[model samples]
Target: MIDIKNLHKSYHMGKNSLHVLKGINFSVSEGEMVSIMGSSGSGKSTLLNILGILDEADEGTYTLDGTLIKNLNEKVAARYRNQFLGFIFQSFNLINYKSALDNVSMPLYYQGVKRNVRTEKAMHYLEKVGLADWASHLPNELSGGQKQRVAIARALASDPKLLLADEPTGALDTKTSYEVMELIQGINDEGKTILIVTHEDDIAHMTKRIVNLKDGLIIDDSKVTQVRAKAENYV
Candidate 1:
């Protein structure tokens, strides 16, 4: 679903260039769950942002589902991102004033979906994530785990082919993080590719494959372990 080659990104820090990513390459197949694991300053987030198309790469080629990313104009990139990808962030990124239902409906609203259709679809996803009862509540009213669940629901409401998550479990406790992982696994089982960037080992273990990044390059790309349903742990 995603093909990346020789990706490079740099930031200016007081006349010095901070080269975060240098020649990273990888491909994600449909329905695959992958993890990019690294410590701070390892460029994992830069890679994720590039993959998510939230940021552009300074040097490299990225093709999503087939179309070359660099070739796209801003408007086309936005539409492609909205249509094919969903994002979950560490901050939850929920509108402070919007109810859970409204937050989940935001993506569809941007897609030009009508109020009624988007509302129904958003509720369907919220129910799938076990947040049907919390729809009327605001983000501040929900627990950390509940807020993350709502974010996941919102990400899935668009029926995206890929989900990009950056440190999704950072704000939650261990137990809550595990529960969030379970929810992510269930979503992957339904055939959406998932790519998550996290520093937590347990969270990395939840993915089918782990790619270790260091100094802006992939040093290890291995199947650490197969992912299992939370009901029956992996053998």
Candidate 2:
């Protein structure tokens, strides 16, 4: 559902320009689970930002589900982001004062969904992430894993076409990380397209495909033997 060709990005600091992405090209089909891997200074984050429409590429083209993503006005960009992309960050990004249910429903609220419908959909996704019983808890009241689960529920509340996860398990322990990956795998199995940016090899292996980046270039892009995440096996 994502197509990119000759994508280039750079940042200017004083007289020098730092190139972040250089002539990148790749395509991710619907229902594919892909992970982006790179060491420090790689263009993975920049690529993710461009894919999420959080940043613009200096050159080349990015077409998300057939729409050319280039120089979108803020209103149109926000609309496309809300309608087509769902984001999961290493930092859960939940509201501290908002309960899990409220956090999950916030996106729907912004979309102008009715209060009842928003609550209904939020709870449905919370249940899907196995957080139905913890809906009343605030982010601070939950553990790291629980908070991420709530965040996942929030991401899914919009039912967006693509999910972008940036180091989704970075803040969790190994067991918790595997648990979360298991949940993510199940989501992908249901036909949701997911693109994850992570530095961890084991985590990348959990995905169906891995794209390796170095010095702003995609050095390797290949399908992998997907490793099923079983939380119990980690310990």
Question: lDDT by residue for model 2 over 92-187, one digit each (tens)?
Answer: 999999999999999898899999999999999999999999999989999999999999999999999999999999999999999999999999
lDDT of 2 at 222: 96
- Candidate whose TM-score is highest: 2
Q: Alpha carbon lDDT of residue 185, candidate 1? A: 92
* lDDT by residue (tens digit), candidate 1, 155-214: 998989889998999998777887889999989988889999999887888899999999
Consecutive 10-residue window with the lowest summed lDDT within model 1: 226-235
C-alpha lDDT values of all predictions = 0.89, 0.96
Identify the leading candidate in terms of lDDT: 2
Q: List residue ranges in candidate 1 displaced over 4 A.
A: 227-235
Clashing pairs in 2: none
